[model samples]
Target: MATEWLGLHFLFGAFLIGAVLSRGAGEHLPRTATQETRQVTLILLLPAYFLLAGLRVDLSALDPSGFGELALVLVVAIAAKTASAFAAARLHRLGSRDLAVLATLMNTRGLTELIVLTVGVETGILDGNLYSMMVIMALVTTAMAGPVLSGLLRPAGGGEQPFSGETAAHDEPLPARHAREETG
Candidate 1:
């Protein structure tokens, strides 16, 4: 089981790394590929992955305690990520649109969270129901990001910065400007 999980992780990691390297190389393979092809490929891969995941779930020794722990972890994970996104947005002084984009990107778990839960189940670290909850948590949190950010960015009145001043971070000051102070 461990070896299978490791192999799966390695394959996923390799795919992600390959994507990053290819993107960095400015390869335009996707541009050449038709939109229909891209859509079909995604549609096919998603169901296959989800089906394999569902098949792997083991439901024999279900426990109730794990649910509480899973809930706590999910809450913490979502809160921490959301708070960090807001903090980073403040520090960077991002506009409403950019902050929303950053928050959305930061909240994205993609397949990574699912992969982690899958590995936990395969390794016997987490039971099936617990794993399912984690999967649900991932889905819910990932889905909420878009709507939450949109709501937060919606205007109430006159123009004001979307992000609060509380978390605003400033970079290093300009030494040249500081040194060349007014002589008057």
Candidate 2:
């Protein structure tokens, strides 16, 4: 853990801070400005980071045991996290959409997982093969969250699915155009 803290931890910490701040800013900013800025930033920055990380990966020491361990870790991670998310969402009375988004975001280990794996490999706590397995686990677990949550939460769209007959259909739009037309 100490070694993991030293090597590449700062990179992920910085990334987390950046993501939080940017997302917070987007939430507060005008929709058009937020969309434009996010698009530009993602287009400019994401590919470069992906390329750099891919180029740095060591692929020589592949191992079967590591793969098995990775599978186990992924199973545990998803089961534990999904259960926890459901509990938390219920406790907070989060709407289905919000709960889905929260679940997806919580599963996104991203660069943080990579940093820990890299540190383990660098410090000999984990071999290259095991590190690779950890990376794979992180990616798979993170990627599944969105689709899973979406499947669970998505409405059929025939009508409003009431949340216990208490919550209103908040996303329903007002008849602004019809009102204007009638007034005019």
The TM-scores of all predictions, comma-separated, are 0.58, 0.52
Q: Highest lDDT among the candidates is held by which one? A: 1
Which 10 consecutive residues of model 2 have the lowest summed lDDT?
A: 164-173
lDDT of 1 by residue, 47-119 (tens): 8887887675543444677667667867887778767886887565654456556766677884787777776
User: Which residue runs does candidate 1 get wrong by more than 4 Å?
Assistant: 1-8, 16-20, 24-37, 54-66, 94-105, 123-129, 157-184
Where is model 2 more than 4 Å wrong at Cα? Answer: 1-41, 56-60, 93-105, 115-126, 156-184
Candidate 1: global Cα-lDDT? 0.65
Candidate 2, residue 164: CA error in Å?
Answer: 9.9
